[model samples]
Target: MTGPGMLTALWLTPLIGALLVVVLPSGARRAARPLALATSLLVLGLAVALTVGFDPGGDTHQFVETRPWIPAFGATYSLGVDGIALVLVLLTAGLMPLLLLAGWHDADGSAPSDEGEHDGGEHDGKRDRKKDDDEVGAAGRRAQVYPALMLATQALALVAFTSLDVLLFYVAFEAMLIPLYFLIGGFGGRVSDGVDRAAAAVRFLIYNLLGGLVMLAAVIGLYVLTARAGLGAGGAGTFDYRIITAAIGDGRLEIPPGVALLLFAGFTLAFAIKAPLWPFHTWLPGAAVAATPASAVLMMAVVDKVGTFAMLRYSLPLFPDAASTAAPVLVTLAVISIVYGGVMAIAQTDLLRLIAYASISHFGFIVLGVFARTEQSAAGSALYMVNHGIATAALFLVAAFLVRRRGTREIGRFGGVQQVAPVLAGVFLVAGLATLSLPGLAPFVSEFLVFVGTFGPYPVAAVLATSTFVLAAIYILWTYQRVMGGPVAPGLEGTPDLGLRERVVVLPLVGALLVLGFYPQPALDVIEPAVAHTVELVGGVR
Candidate 1:
C-alpha cells in the first residue's frame, strides 16, 4: 500500500526539527546540528521511500493528501508529488544533510562562545591573539539560528513543491523568505569590497516581495475567472490546482487573450526574478557572495529551483497560448543570461560571486529547455534542475572549504593549492568540470539533452547559447589553473587538505554526478511521463 501521510511527514519533519532547535536550552545549542542532520536524514529516507513506491508509468500525483485549510478562499492543505516534484524534493532532502556536515566546523566556529576564559598560564600571548580571532568568528556565527532557518526553509520549500492549491503554493513561497532573510542579513558571509549583507538581504526581499504581490493579483484574477465560468468548487472561484487546471484544459473556463497575457506576465516576472534571469538576476551575485556557503547552496541549488519549477508547473500549463506567444522573448532572455552570466563569471575575483554567475548561465539552459516546450527538452530541464543542485552544491561546498582554509574568497590570494591539497584540488576540479558539463559527468547528459531538444525548435537560440560551453571552460579551468596550478604561494604551506569529514561531505555530491552521468536512464524514466503530460497540456510535440 502507498504510504499515507508520507508527503505531510516529509515537510513536517523539518518543521518540527526547527521547533525543537528553538526550544532547546541555550546550553544545549550544541545539539542543534545533530538534530538538524538527523531530521534531514529522516526526510531523505522518506523521499527515497516515496520515490521507490512511485509508479513511474502513472500520470497522476502520488501519495495525495488534502484537507480544508482556507475553504472560504477555496484553498486546501494539499500535498502530492509527480515525478518532477519528487526529483526536486529528493534534491532538497539529499543536499541538506551534506550541507550540514560541510558546515559542521564552520558552524562551531560561528557559534557565540566565551574564548577569553582559557586556563591561566596555559595560554601564551600569541595563543591569546588566536583566541581573540576565534571569539570574533564565534560572535559572527549564529550556529543555532543558521540550522533552524535552513530547516524552516526546507519545510516551506517542500510545501511549495508539493502543494496542489495555488494559494497554498503562494503562501509557502512567501513564507520561505522569512528564514532566508534572517540567514542572509544576520549570519551572512564576511563582507568584502563594500557588499553589505544586510543590503543584499533587503534587495532580495524587495524584489521577491514585489514579484509575489504581482502574482497574488494574478491568483485573484484566476479565481474570479474560474468563478465567472462556474468552473470551481460549488461554482465559486477556487484556488484548487486540480479544478483550475481541469477547467482550463477542458475549455470550461475561458480567459481573454489580454487578460491571459497579463496574468502570464505576472507569474513569469516573479519566477524570473527568483530564477534571477539576466537583468532580473542582479540581486543574486551580491547575495550569494555575502551569504554563508551552506546558505548559498540552499538558496541557489534548492530554493532557486522553485522559480523554474513554478514556470513549468503553473505558467506554461495554465497559459499555453501566452507561453507560446511569449516563447521568443523568454528564449531571447535565456540566451542573454547564458552569455552574460558566463562572461561576467570570467571577470569575477570573488569565488562565490563567480559561482553565482555560473548559476545564472546554468539557469539560462533550464529556462531555454522549459520554454522550448518539447518533451525531451522539458524532461532534460527537469533533470538539469537535479544535476545542477548536485554540481553546484559540490562546487559551493568545496569553495567554502577553501575559503575556510585560506581566510579569503579572493581568487588572487592563492596559488599551487593542488601541490599541497591534492585531494581537495581533485574534488574542486571534478566539481568545476561538472559545472562546465564535461563528458562522463552528470551534468553533460542533461546539458546535451537540453541542447539537442532546443536545437530542434530554436536552432539559432540553441547555437547562441552553446557559446556558454566555451565560456564555462574558460572561467572554470582558468580559475583552476590560476588558483591551484601555479607554484605554491608563500604562507600557504600549512593549508590542510580535505579531512575525512570534508571528504565524506563532498564525495556523495561528486559520486552522484558520476553515477547519474553514466546512468541517467533511471532518472529519465521517472521524468518522462510528467514531461509528456506537460507537453501535451501545452500542445507541444513529443
Candidate 2:
C-alpha cells in the first residue's frame, strides 16, 4: 500500500522465516512447522492488505518498488504486482498455510527400510539399534528441513509472481526447482511401483532446466536487440520488463519478425513445459505421485501457475504479434492436452497420478482460454487459473488423505470408503465434484467463461476442449464409485475419518470452492482489468 518495501517483504518474510527455521535449535525442532505456519498466516494477512490497497483500475503495476541492482547491466531489483499477478500472489499466499497444515506430519517419517524383515535373527538386535538411530536422525532432520523448504518455496514463488523484470522472473522461476526437488524426493511418498522418488525429482528438474536454458538464450537475444535499438535502461541491454513493454507499446523498438518468433518460441516452450502441456507433460504424473500430497499440490496449484502467469505477463505483451500468429497452433495443442490428459487420468490406478493428469487437462482449458485472446476467454483463463488451483488442491489433498489411510494409491485397493469414514468420503466427493466442474461449484463459472470466450473465436477448439465435461465426469465419478461406493476394501475397515487438524486444513478449501462457484464476482473484479490489458496488447484477436 505504501511503497516497494511491502513487495520485498512479501518474499522476504518467508525467506526470513526460512532462515529462522533453519537456525532453530535441534531441541526446538517441533517448533519449525508452527513457525512456518505463523509466517504463512502473516503473509496471508499481508496479501489481504495488499488487496485492499491495490486499486484495480489504477496503475497497471501497483505498489511499485525499484532499485538499482546492476546499473551497468541495466538490471534492477524490480518488483511490482498487477491484477493478474495480484490474484496469483493471493493464491500462493492463501495456499501456503493450508499446505503447511496438510503436511504437518509429512516430514516426520524416516528413511524406509525393510532389510530387517528378511535379515537373520542373529542381527535383529543390531538392526533394531540401527533403525532407531536412523529414525532419530530423520526426526531431527524433519524438524527443520521440511518446513524450511515450504517457506522457501513460498518465498521464491512470490518473487516470481511479483517480479516486473525479465531476469528476476527467470531467476525465481528456475530457483523454484531446488526446494521442489527435495520436497518431492526427500519428503515424497513412494507410489506402489516403488520407483525411486529421487528419480522423479530428477526428471522434473531436468525438464524444467532445459526449458530455462533455452529461455536464457532468448533472454540474451532480447537484451542484444534492445541494446542495439538503444531501448535498454542504460545505453546498454536491460532486463526491465516495463521498459521493454512500454517501448513496444509506443513503437520505439520493433523486434524483427524472425527474432520475435524465436523469442516467442523460447518463452512459450518454457512455459508450456512448466505448464506441462501435452507432450512435454510426462514428468508431472511421476513427480506428483512421488511427492507428498501437500508438496504435489504446492507444485501444481502454486508453483506451476507461474508458467501460465508468465505467458500472460511476459510472452503475450513482449511479442503480441508473434503470440497472435501462434494462437491457432497453441490452441490446437491445448485441445489435445485436454483430451490426452483426461484419457490418461481415466487410466490411472494411482490416486496422485490421476489428480496430476486431471490437472494437465484443467491447464489445457486455461491455456486455450489464454491464446484464444478474447475478452471473456482471457478473463476466464485468469479466473480458471485460480479456480483450478483451489479445486485441484482440494481434490488432491482429500484424496491423499484417503490414500494415506489405506496405505496405497491404487484405486482397486479402495472401496466403500464412505462406509467407514463418511466425512472423508464426503470431502472427497465435494472435491471430485468440483474437479468435474459441477454446477454451483467454483470451477464451473470460470470454466463456462473459458468455453464461452473461446467459442466466439476458435469454435472448433472450444468444441473439442468441452469434451472434458464428459471426460472429467467419467474419470471423477468412475474413480469415486470405485473408491468410495461399493464396500470398504480389506485393510481399510479400520480407517479413521478426518481429524480435527485435517478438518482445519480442508474445510476452508471446500468453502472457497462453494462460495466462488456461486458468486465469482469479487475475484472477477480483481482479475478483469489485467486480462483486459493483456487482450488489448495481443490486438484483441487471435
Best by TM-score: 2
Q: What is the lDDT of residue 78 in candidate 2?
A: 95
Which tens-of-lDDT digit does each residue in 431-540 have in candidate 2?
99999999999999988998999998899998898899999999999999999999778888899999998999889999999999999998898888888877777787
- What are the clash counts of all predictions, listed in order? 1, 1
Q: Each prediction's Cα lDDT score?
A: 0.88, 0.88
- What is the lDDT, from 0 to 100, of the residue 288 in candidate 2? 89
Local accuracy of candidate 1 as per-residue lDDT tens digits, 1-542: 24788899999999999888767776676787888899999999988898889999875688989999876667788888988999999999999999888767545553422233447588889988887787654543456767889999999999999999899999998899899898787765644444587889999999999999999999999888878987656867788887777777899878899999999999999899988798899989988877778888899998899999999999998898899999999999999999999999999998878999999999999999999998888998999999999999999889889977898888999899999999999999999999999999999999899998899889999999889889999999999998899899887899999999999999999999999999999999888888888898888768
- Cα-based TM-score, every candidate: 0.94, 0.96
